[model samples]
Target: MGALFFVKHKPTCREIDIVKLTIYTDYSLRVLLYLASKPDATATITEITEYYNISRNHLVKVVHNLGIHEFIITSRGKNGGIRLARPAEDILLSDVVRKTEPDMDLLECFNPKTDNCVISPTCRLKSMLYEGRSAFMAVLEKNTLADAAGPITQAKSGEAVYVNISRLKR
Candidate 1:
């Protein structure tokens, strides 16, 4: 009698093609972009909510997280508002994505401690996914908040005129 064992197989590109950021991360980037455009002034959640037409409650949480991560500075009181903690040029897009994203694991096999897949031990898919993720992050690491914010125009009143966030190309 012989014992049977399972063989590991490499995943196809299509099998490991799922890569999507959470809405929270998207909102976090939006907040950063908005603040980057208004570098000289602070902005309130209400203003951002109105501009993006998103839920104020969701933005409040995003703002709090951004503050906690030191991505933005928050002030309290009558004149309170939020602004970038540092210059937009100094803030890396990769850092924001890492800070805002709760989980970056591309698949169940990426985390060894929690991974229970039979093929995880021998699978090449995890390595391929790791390479893909690394390439994606490398692109972000090369860019800063200022790069994503694009150009900031000024109105006749000297106020910063920003691109319409809602109408931005996805």
Candidate 2:
């Protein structure tokens, strides 16, 4: 009854399918897309946090992970902050999703030692899950950060923020 967003039906014990993205994944995608749209804007953490009005605390880990994955480069100096390692077109959404959702194993029964799956030896779940993940990425691969930023580029609902794609239309 005290849950923040999720509310259990209490009558049905349906396995709560976690088909949603995590904040870590969410922020990574948002930040990367935002940065990619900025076009030569090497924005700082403070500036980004302010633009999106997101918590700097949560974004810290996301930014750090992005740097480690080589999707983005970070530096400290007067002209240093964070910037894309490669061009926006070169960086695929699938790549970002893959790096961000590293632990997206659908089932744990595939493990050898503590295999919870009773049919571990012949279970097809692992293969199926792999296919599903692949298919998901296949869809995402078709679009780039520039594509996902469709509505974001149009109609000013508030103050001017960095990377407003709406303003870039020719």
Candidate 3:
């Protein structure tokens, strides 16, 4: 074989410092971050869904949670939709992630003793993941919605503010 190389099917991951939270976590943040970038700005759920090309079904959950978590306010009117509840700078990135993440457990092993995997009783993996998690949260804590978002000025026609993995980079 010439220049043969076997690549392990490792899952591709985002290069951002924070560990992948979840699609729930991911979309929730995107909703807020998008609106935060447009503080004093608002968009309909349909608008956001169309701009992101994400299923409205999926975004509805995120938008609902944002409403429940007090991260955003929704208005029912032909001229209104959703807007950031507070100034973007006031919302901490860590806070949003904390509220959005399903569970804090970094690994399954953290749960009650199960699966006699030789090192289960003495493995430092759990603690290590914890430490890493803390560090990750601390990094995100340093940035606020404002930092994650761009300044909100005037909403221009044909102007889209939603951000995507491809639009932004690590």
By TM-score, who's the top model here? 1
Tell me which residue pairs clash in candidate 2: 153-165, 153-166, 154-166
lDDT of all predictions, in order shown? Answer: 0.79, 0.67, 0.67
Q: Candidate 3 residues 27-124, lDDT tens each? A: 77778766765566778899888766788999988998989999999988778799988887899988887887766654545445433345656876
Ranking by TM-score: 1, 3, 2
Please give the lDDT score for candidate 2: 0.67
> For candidate 2, lDDT tens digit of each residue in 67-88?
9999889999888899888877
- If scored against the real structure, what TM-score would every candidate get? 0.81, 0.69, 0.74
TM-score result, candidate 2: 0.69
Off by over 4 Å in 2: 1-16, 110-114, 119-130, 151-170
TM-score of 3: 0.74
lDDT of 3: 0.67
True-vs-predicted CA distance for residue 138, candidate 2, Å: 1.4
Q: Candidate 1's residue-wise lDDT over 146-165, tens digit each?
A: 87877667899997676534
The 10-residue segment of model 3 with minimum total lDDT is 1-10
RMSD of 2: 7.7
